[model samples]
Target: MEYARRFPGGARAADLLLCLAITAPLLLPDHDGFAPTGLPLGWMRIAAAPLLALAVLISRRRPVAAAAVPAALGLAASPELHTAVGFAVAQVTLAFLLGHRAADRPPALWLFAGVLGAGGLALLAAPDADFEDGGTLVANVLLVFVLPWLAGQGMRQRAELDRAGWQLAERLERERHLVVHQARLRERARIATDMHDSLGHDLALIAVRAGGLKVAADTSPQGREAAEELRRSAAAAARRLHEVIQVLREGDETAPLRPAGESVAVLVHNAKASGIPVTLDDLLSDGDALPPMTERAIFRVVQEALTNAAKHAEGAPITVTMSRDGRNAVVTVTNDAPAVGTTPPVPPQNANGHGLIGLDERVRQAGGTLHAHPTAKGFTVTAHLPLSAGAPATPPRAASTTREHAATTRRTARRRALHTIGLPTAGITVLLLFMALNDHGTDSSLLEKHKYNELRIGESQQVVEDRLPARQLRPEHRPARPNGADECRYYGTDPDSFTPAYQLCFTAGRLSHKDKVVLSRVG
Candidate 1:
């Protein structure tokens, strides 16, 4: 009720601890009698059982002073045993605590069947009240009336299963922090749309070839070799804008495969310096010792398939390849054919360049697989990867063959870590010298007579076959020895004719196929 008037001293100390837990179970000793019924206990039934348990602890903050002071101090109290069991357990705990209070309006089920049908008709109008003791008045109306309505319906179903497991664990931790804050705002809007389409198409082709080399500086030698090829393509687009701002300020949390600044024959001679002819061939030599995330995921799947074949097949030739084998490395490429009547080019859809979705998330973060398609005679791509021993694809570094291949690759990685640490330290030194010679009894005095019968008297399979007679396992029988010519019982015997020994000792072995007869001439 407005949080019970902002907690009136915790609602008067929860109405004096619910009037001392309902008169401390009616001051404990009245097992239904106190001089049969002189009745009125001393201090007026302990001040009418704490004023009928503080009128059912202020029935939800005074439900009409909790129904006229616990039904007129339990119908003027003088009957007996703590005024008929503390006024029928504070009148069924003030009608199940004012039927769980939302500022109460509850009292109707014919007002608890006319107040428990007028206290079961004034308790069968008591003339010394034991009307055939009707099972002690139906066990005092189920212990002072339906055990507090089944303990207030089991504390309202365990407070609605602890408020539905704290609102389903706070809605699954707010949907896992809203899917990791929408994948870091989609990787910062894909590196700001690939740095605004590779530095706005190389600064608008070096500002239209520096305004046609300042109006043909002293008249065109092919516009000063196309304005010194637009100042060496704007100083190689300022070293690819400082290698894409040091790979977007070093983010893929370290995708560093650092060496080959350029290849696949200098990326098909820089895609024939963007005029797109390409062609390349085999390549490897220290392909950055393999894993710098598998050579930066096959060099961003061949730089986004040669920047989508120079922005969609502009003079296509393409080809490339790269290989390996044991523990794969592939790479492919494809291109060379779609120019005849020009119709193949598609890849330009760019709602923020995750160029072919960041080359399939950099070949699945280097756990490889890239693909791309289209090829009847054009557009391809591909990738593969997976290699590690601190990365390896080495081949062409020739300074004295790169110090004799780095001293034969550090003596073949120190002979594979000394043959994998001398095969498990010689198999744990032959299992600690066969468990220290089977614990001191050298080879076998029946393993020190089964470790002195497992420490004097136990483990009985007949004291382990009388101290292990060669670890006794001989009972599979065939004993008709004195040259009786019928010895073949290694399980399924067939020595000519003991009719598989009366079908395995009289069929106990479940004889099948006309019940056993594999006896072939062996007399």
Candidate 2:
């Protein structure tokens, strides 16, 4: 079924074949018996039947127009010819096709109803017709036209329901994929937070402990120098580890750095204390007035730029600038080229080379932009952070909100399934029960009392009529020679039933033979 939906031309071709099947019967020689006779235009009217059948065949593409062709042709053909079974069948098929194939229902239904009214009037006025009475004609029209129209309507509703179900399933599938992807992202964020909080703190403590060991007086002079080198290296390694952890915590709820509003002057002072030749141009004297998130982003940006400059451009003079431009806080860090004989420091093993990438994400989360590139003399890093209070401090969706949205989507899908599937199933069940109760068959009580062995030979016809109603007898299974002196058979079972049935044969109005027979079941 999914494959067929992908290529709908195959289904349209099948519908075309069905239209041909319904129309081909009207073009046969049997339909010519009802053709007009003893008139100069009789042959033309006979030809119109085939032409109308051809029009019905063309209606598969244009249902509304095709439906009108047969109806108009039928009304123009002859009032006497309306009694023909082929004529009635053609109109019924056209009515069903109109409702089944029309893109819109209101117009199709109105057109069909108009055609039915015209055809019913013609059928009633038909000369010497089987349905001449007003009540009989109305009943006939209801059976032949209205019932088939209702069936077509049901088919249209079912098709619409199937399409809606397919669309809903597709939407739900996409939502499921989105929810799963969000969950994976949240898990990664959680892991990043844990690593930064535990591992980062431990690395900082290690650097502090190594610095204390270097200044202790109990150590020898050579050991003191070695401890000093260890302390310097450990401090460098700790700074590199912090950059890596910051990158890992890009999309996490909590910032990897201290959430307190740290001063940019303090960040610059620390870099100069680390033996780097640096200069600061502070434009915001009172930096504590800025939002905590904006200040944190600015501090991290300057810290990373200074660290990179110290490692890659040793002995280079660096400049740091901070200012407020309209609604934004702009920070730029630039360093001069290293001396000709200078060599860059070796990067630590723990570095993942994602420091700048993580910094960009952090700046973006704070509604800011960061740019880092090499100049003719040295490298420069610049960041612009929005000072607006409305700037978002995190990603669009949090873990809690994503889970709630997924749950809501699931509940909506369940409700849609119940309305679309459950309601239709219940309606069909009720219709089947109504049909069973109203079916033209022998009552259960009659079948229980009249088993095959109970009827004896030579019983009068009047005697059997007392036990079973005449309407319960199967006409097709009746005796072949009822007017002859030969035995006449009357089967006692429902016409549509497959159970073991009883047959009573009468000759000269008296029961002559009785037997049990198994009826053939229709598929």
Please report, in order, the local distance difference test score of every candidate based on alpha carbons: 0.52, 0.63
In Å, residue 203's CA in model 1 sits off its true spot by 2.5
lDDT of 2 by residue, 1-523 (tens): 2322445587566545555665554554322113332132345446655666566557767777766665565456543334333455666776776666665777766765675576567656666555544444455445555676667778877878867876776677677657555544443453455445656677677767777887888988888788778778777876776676566554434454443334678777877898899999988655547764576678778877887888889999999999998888999999989989988889664223556655766666677888899999999999888877669644433334444664587679769989998999899989976864434233331243334456667778788656643333344443334343455444445433534556566787877766656545311
Choose the strongest candidate by lDDT.
2
For model 2, the run of ten residues with the poorest summed lDDT: 30-39
| Candidate 1 residue-wise lDDT, 276-304, digit = tens | 77776676644556754566567657766
- Residue 481 lDDT, candidate 1, scale 0-100: 36
Give the worst 10-residue stretch by lDDT in candidate 1: 504-513
Residue pairs with clashing backbones, model 2: none
TM-score of each: 0.28, 0.40
Candidate 1 residue 371 Cα shift, in angstroms, is 36
